[model samples]
Target: MKRILIILFIFLLSACNDNAAVEELKEDYPEIKEVAEQFPESVQEKLAAPTVLPFEPKNVSLTYAGDMPGNPKRDILHTEFIYGDGVGVNLHVTTYHNKNTTWSSDEKTMKTVKLKDGTEALIEGDAINVKQIRWKKDGTYYSIMLIKAPKVEKEYTIDDVVRTANSMEY
Candidate 1:
């Protein structure tokens, strides 16, 4: 009985932590909160968005990409936040129901980083710019990509992407 009580306490504590994290994300990104509220609780939990972004986005949009190719029941969600028409930061956050799968990249360009929750995230890019950050948590795969844009004065760095990934609430 004592052991069961202890386990229950731990579970409740973790749930509270998750709730706090979700509240923080909602407070930090009202757009995410607004859009997420439109979905069911199950879908909302899978639709994780970053609390941090590299640039101040001029526009933000979320799209339901339907199911994954092989898995008809698994859904895909794509959220995009962009800063400029064609020349500034364009961040894409994609979430799907799957074991964490990462995009193929040259081995030389891929490295792993530990997120705040100690999840291993695969980052693919060069020394100066980060192309993508991918990680999996709670049976869901999440990816954040910096889409190539023309006439950009500055490109986001690996640190920027890492910060964004860490800010994601599962």
Candidate 2:
């Protein structure tokens, strides 16, 4: 019963295209007004035009596992970069482990052309940071975790390292 009340309370706070829905329901029931009245007008404005909602980033998505690639001490934070005509850069900062510099140390000349649906990245010694552009796969979002140091590097592997973050809604 308590959980039901709480759930109803939260629903009352959510944005609505019309107030009539609540009114119609409440016309036969008056107890809902307490929960509705607690809501601030600011949140209500979202009904007209929502600025932000619970949404996963469009194209790319990261998945964090128990440990990171290459090093068990590291953790990956992943998210999909939206694939499109735009920009992105993945970052990681930690102590003890060197960021992966696989991109900077490659002797082979790297391709300069930006491939559509490719994540351009910056790499340091142990971190494989990629500036991810999104790509669609089986209707799921994904980003390549690659590394590129400024100069001097070996081959940059597509599966080097990538991490995902967590999100929750109330």
Candidate 3:
């Protein structure tokens, strides 16, 4: 119940795409708002805008996850690439132009790591739990979230997340 309430609170906060927030985001991420104006004719076209992982785990496939048009919490071009099952890896790719590179993720819960390409990344949570790999590359942000389920046999690691993040091609 506590977890549900927390999640609901976050959802409410994120869904508060009120005029003020939208205006603030327009100022904060103007490029994203510009892109939003030119949002592709179709969601399929928008899905084609993001860089994809060059190397994917066996049996894992990419899917077109939808977007929230006119979202005000952040003005971003969002494309999601789900690498395995919903119980496996959920990669969220967000493109926006902002000087603020920091994410809402709690720094206390994340450990910083340096990627092979010399880029800095944050590993959220713990390795044995639902971990996420977050990094900013070439002005774009990539978040690789690992979802472990009871029936899922595959066990993912931080290395796997980093490798997948590294394999992304813009």
Candidate 4:
């Protein structure tokens, strides 16, 4: 009986993990992987609270499936995400940050652009600073930019923004 139970437990664990991985893929694109590949992992750790991660192409595909906006050009870190909550958003970020504009609502303003693909089923949500953390209450997705200037000021999501808002940092 013990052997049978253990086998079932392992199988169940594996199954659950697989589902979660798939769900995460569908929810948050492994955009972090792309950024991590180029930059040091410590960057993610050093990230300050209320940081608005640069929207990467990987984030867009994972968050929402569709081709990225504009041509696949360099310099501009443009991308878009698809949400299951009947919402879609595109992001256009720059690698260089103006020193004078280092930190201000000016850099954290919002803009409304049309999804070139125009095939996703989602509602456009508000911008979390320059970042768009929409809830794919319906897709799967994740990231910060590899070349960053610390302009991340928002993370719009259907869920609580500061989930750890109440939890301790222990």
lDDT: which candidate is best? 1
**Each candidate: what lDDT?**
0.65, 0.29, 0.52, 0.29
- Tens digit of per-residue lDDT, candidate 1, span 110-145: 688888899988875544434787777877777787
Best by TM-score: 1
Q: Which residue ranges in model 2 land beyond 4 Å of their true spot? A: 1-5, 8-141, 151-156, 162-170
| Worst ten in a row by lDDT for model 1 | 78-87
TM for candidate 4 is 0.23
Give the lDDT ranking, best first: 1, 3, 2, 4
In candidate 4, what residue range of length 10 has the lowest lDDT sum?
A: 161-170
Model 2 Cα lDDT, one tens digit per residue, 1-170: 99999998888776443545334423433543443333333322211111121222222211222243345344322211221111233322111111221223452343322222343332223334343222222222333333344452343333223222111011
TM-score of 1: 0.61
> What ranges in model 3 sit over 4 Å off?
1-77, 86-102, 127-129
Q: C-alpha displacement of 63 in model 1, angstroms?
A: 0.9
TM-score of each: 0.61, 0.19, 0.49, 0.23
lDDT of 4 at 86: 16
